[model samples]
Target: MEYDPTLPWYRRLHWQVLSAMILGLGVGWAFGLPAANAIGWIGELFMKLLRMIIVPLVLTSIVSGVASVGGGRAIGRLFGKTMGYYVLSSMLAALTGLLMVNLIRPGQNADMGAAAQQEVPELSTPDSAVDLILDIVPNNFFAAASAGDMLAIIFFCIVFGAAITGLPEKPRVVVTDIFNAFFQAMMALTSGIIKFLPIGVFALITKMVGETGFDRFAALAKYFATIGSGLTIHLFITMPLLLIVLGRIKPLVHFANLREPLLTAFSTSSSGATLPVTIKTLREKVGVSNKVSSFVLPMGATVNMDGTAIFECAGALFIAQVLGVDLTIGQQAIVVLTALLASIGAAAVPSAGVVVIFIVLNAIGLGDNPEAITIVGAMLAIDRPLDMYRTAVNVFSDSCGAAIIARSEGEEGVDTEVRH
Candidate 1:
């Protein structure tokens, strides 16, 4: 296929996203909340459309990727590399956030009294670790699909993929080809839907900015600044350091290659929603092999959440500080471990961070009081912006994981030296 340079800039995905963000901010500021509210349906519709396709896309892509990895041995290697990177990066991110929050103490000056007035929903404590494990298995695929439980979907995909691997050659080839075609069709559909992303993003942002206003921003200024600062440090400093030292890729080139997907993830605030863009950027711009990008990005979207993990850790500490709860060394260790695991367990959905925050609070004994949960609610008022920032980090880490995995797989010819 020949490159088409005559396409209008607005027709391009990234440019559209940029335009939406700019226009959204402008509209929100000018006409205020009511005007922003009028267009809220556009963002709602966009999210619904994305949610509609998520289950099938995740299922088909993961199953096809796993099946293509071939028998038990290849699957083992792929799993090891993929999970290893996820676990390590997620832990590092969690720790990074934890360290920053501890040092800065963003909530130290905040009043918990105002937060106490907000009615906090009573959260049920999960029975045990075993119960959590049991919950991973989907009793009904339809139920899981309806609920958009990504971990459950991932569980199903792995098993289904393995089954595909065991089938006889003729049948396997036919089944694989069918899935491949389905995956492509879904991608095409996603592309068409994303053409409206600018509209959706504009609506979403305008609503957010219009609703919150400058007053709320002033109230949570410190907390937002803390999380934002942490994300910036990780995205610019830590991640790039890893890219250069561990991945052996130039940081600027990797960032340049990742511009499109990073922006998409930032705008969407859902890594799963940004998968198509991530895959395309890795394959086309960064020159990762399809086999690598296809395998890594989907799995990373599920299990590899460096950004969310970081937010969870920082959020936990911020809440703890506001509540005057002093976490011990042992308790901090528990936060690290739980946040890492919780990141893996978190569903790749819009409000998933709230659920994960609840889990983290419960783990650290902060869930006993309704007041603590209310404090989290205060955090939620500013969560959307921070969510976008963290999501960009999430997608960046995923791409880095892909590059590292691709190198290990001997598919490094795509970018021997990452371009600036």
Candidate 2:
């Protein structure tokens, strides 16, 4: 675009982000670590605010969406389609990563000496999968909500929504209208918060860069290259092709509508924080029905982490290789299955990916020692960039899912103009 010099400063998200990033980098480099440390607090504050809203927003939106499904059969179909798409897309993303990493052999020459300086901390092993499933049932809803336990929250929302559906029509209408207003209000609030994203992103990026410097990139070059290359291939090749062939939408137009949210997600690195932008872009710009966008985006943000799932599987394999552990074909299959399940269990909370990785490592029998956890710490050091890529994938996957769902609902032709 065009710049309106007369417009207020906050009216321009791009300008704000660019300015913040440049200024933050200058301050970080010139003033050394102290300035960067102070600025980091601002990013943490922004994430805290967004996270504070996620549970309530997800609960309300999901309950409302499920309640809109008029009957049991309708609800069943929607659930089937939503979950089916998540599984397929996530598995494809994981497999794509595996293929690329193996083809490139990015970790073949990894320097264990460089990784020697890293300190591995002892971590408690994760509970079994059965225990993880059992933990989904909240002993106390208030505690679960307060803790932002996503699976429990989702469980509660579905039950609450189903109950609302079973109510009389007049009462159900009022409840639905009330929730509609609630969701709209939350969206508005989210939009207001997003205006501050550039500041948050700048702080987050500058602090990370200042602490690690550029040398860390060299040390983990192979790992980074592997993940980055996989992400690029998926974004440019797999996703666009899928959109064109399966969704029957123009990929160029679809991407144009997605630009703002995708960029915001890249910069901010929190899919939960990016949810407002994703929903707005999907419904207003890409012509996805509100029914589909509302139902899919929130759930996708929580469960459909295609990028992270791929990274977890690929990263695990890399770790196993570096540790000189040869995994059988059956074990590799287990890795794929466990990564898919772990991605769903992984919440959208801050630094939650680290926990998810730990869970994955434990499942693969690497959790007995500090080596696996140290690998994770190394991954965490470069997580900002990886997070950006993954969030984009997450948003892209959600958009495609929304398009497919819209097509299924016969609302694909609702609008042709790009809404961004």
lDDT of each: 0.78, 0.75
lDDT of 2 by residue, 194-281 (tens): 7787878788767766665555667778888888888888788888887777667777877767777787677677787777777766
Q: Highest lDDT, which number?
A: 1
TM-score of each: 0.89, 0.88
The pairs that clash in candidate 2 are: 285-419
- Per-residue lDDT value at 75 in model 1: 76
Q: Per-residue lDDT for 35-77 in model 1, tens only?
A: 7679877887877787778778777777778888888788778
User: Any idea what lDDT model 1 has?
Assistant: 0.78
Error of 2 at 169 (Å): 2.2
Cα RMSD (Å) between model 1 and the true structure? 2.9
Evaluate model 1: give its TM-score.
0.89
Could you tell me how far off, in angstroms, the CA of residue 56 lies in candidate 1 after the best superposition? 2.1
